[model samples]
Target: MKQLMQALIDQGARLIGLVGLPPMGCLPAVITLTSPFSPRQCNESLSQIAIDFNQKLQSELKAMQTDQGPTIVYFDIYQPLIDILQNPSQFGFDETNIGCCGSGLIEATFACNVGSKICPDPSKYVFFDSIHPTEATYNYIFKKMQPVIDEIIQGQ
Candidate 1:
């Protein structure tokens, strides 16, 4: 990621932005289909990893925020996913587990077709696919982060 950042710098990139990971618990498939054998992430290690990763992301962004470099940011994907999962009704939805298309409770995939079980409206779902956010989810994320984005881009 650092090397990529420097490469972006070399190539005259500006205004770096990121959309980060959401909480794992809220993913329907992750919750429903995840391997029980898969051990829970060690808190000590996960915390360290989060700290290290955040530091690195910040370092890379700060490095690029120099006079001749772009202002960079790591979007907070964690909270939005949490908020959506915790309060789907706030976003005009009644369910978070039900996807807008694909195999509903079984799987989420790109094979949405004529008979696929699509939700009534996509605007309310937290995720569009089994693993990705829908347009609605993306819009919500954008709107939620708009202030931070504006602040960062505005050099505030």
Candidate 2:
């Protein structure tokens, strides 16, 4: 991923945003990836994969934080999402771990939707299904995190 980003920069790409995964292996998709029999405890021996990579790039970006160049910007979507999930009630969400979709521990393909039975109130839910969020949930997340983005832009 780093190599690919660097290549894009070398090729004169202007903007870049690393909106990486949100602890995805913890999500329901993995259950089907292995099986329902798979235990969550198995993901214990985790590597510092995204953190290491992003921090390295972040340091580079810090150095390149000058008011020059064609907007060497980075949008870190991971940290804020994790923070939101940790405090879902702040965003009017009573639940975070359980998806609105009834397809427990299955892939996002079997997600909650119109045809697939979904929660009557998507606004109260964090995830619309195993992977995505409802529009209202996204709106709440956006409103909550707008300050972070505004600060970054203003400080820059």
Candidate 3:
């Protein structure tokens, strides 16, 4: 990470944003794979791993952000996403466990297609496929990140 940052700095890059990992256990794919019977529940083990990684990453990023080259910003999408998943109705999301495409249990990428079954409203789902977030979910994340982005831009 330090090397990459230096490389970017060498090329005249100033501001850098690093996104934290989402709760992988809450994703449709992980739930389907690890807790098929209890689809609504997320795999806590995987979620913990992501959480730990995010914490470490945040710490590292903070250490990297000196008066040296670039201003490294760590964008935490984990908490906001988890908040939405825990309270779907708050974010206008009806489905937090399953995705909008196909069975929403395991389908992803090319597996989601015209032939595959889809939810009536994609906006009501947190995930578009098994692993990706829907547009609405991304909108929420973007809004949450807006303040930080504004601060970075204003500072520059």
Candidate 4:
């Protein structure tokens, strides 16, 4: 990823925005697979991997930000996602353990199609399906990322 970003810089790109991975362990699909209980929770081990990967990416990006390198901005999407999971009520989401579409367990993409059962209120759920977030979740993340994005745009 760093190499590709650097190559883009070499190709005359002045600004590069890198969005870090979200908390994969906290995803409904991952919880269903890893959790032993009925109401699944986040798999800490899996979450750790995402955190570690993001940290490594941040470190590498910092190292690569020499005088010749392009202005690279690392947008930390992990923390805000984690915050939403931990405090769903604060984010106006009532469901954090499961998704809004289908059974809210393993359904994703095609499985969450027309015939699938959906929740009455999608806004109450953080995820649209097992692997994907709802529009509200994305909007919340975008709002949280705005300050960093603005700073980057201002060259701060």
Which has the greatest lDDT? Answer: 3
Q: Candidate 3, which segments miss by more than 4 Å at Cα?
A: none
lDDT of 1 by residue, 51-108 (tens): 4665677666666567766777777766776677767788776657645677544465
Q: Tens digits of per-residue lDDT for model 2 on 1-156?
A: 556656877888665544444544334454245335634311312214555666777787766644544455555655655666767787688656546776534536634445776666767776666667657667765776577578767865
Ranked by TM-score from best down, the candidates are 3, 4, 1, 2
- Cα lDDT, all candidates: 0.65, 0.58, 0.91, 0.88
Report clash pairs, candidate 2. Answer: none
Error of 3 at 108 (Å): 1.3
153 Cα displacement, candidate 3 (Å): 1.2
- Candidate 2, lDDT over the whole model: 0.58
TM-score, cand. 3 vs. native: 0.94
Quality of model 4 by C-alpha lDDT: 0.88
User: Which whole-number lDDT from 0 to 100 does residue 121 have in model 1?
Assistant: 76
Q: What is the lDDT of residue 88 in candidate 4?
A: 93
| Preferred candidate (lDDT higher): 1 or 2 | 1
- For every candidate in turn, the CA RMSD to the true structure comes to 4.6, 4.2, 1.3, 1.7
Two-way lDDT contest, 2 vs 4, winner = 4
Model 1 clash pairs are none
lDDT of 3 by residue, 1-156 (tens): 888888888899888889999998999999988888953689989999999999999998888787876889999899999999999998899988889998898999999988999889999999999999999999999999999999988998
Query: Candidate 4 on 1-156: residue-level lDDT in tens?
Result: 766886797799888888888999999988988984775889988899999999999998898887866787789889988999999999999999789998788899999999999999998999999989998999999999999888886875
TM-score of candidate 4 on Cα atoms, chains taken together: 0.91
- What residue pairs clash in candidate 4, if any at all? none
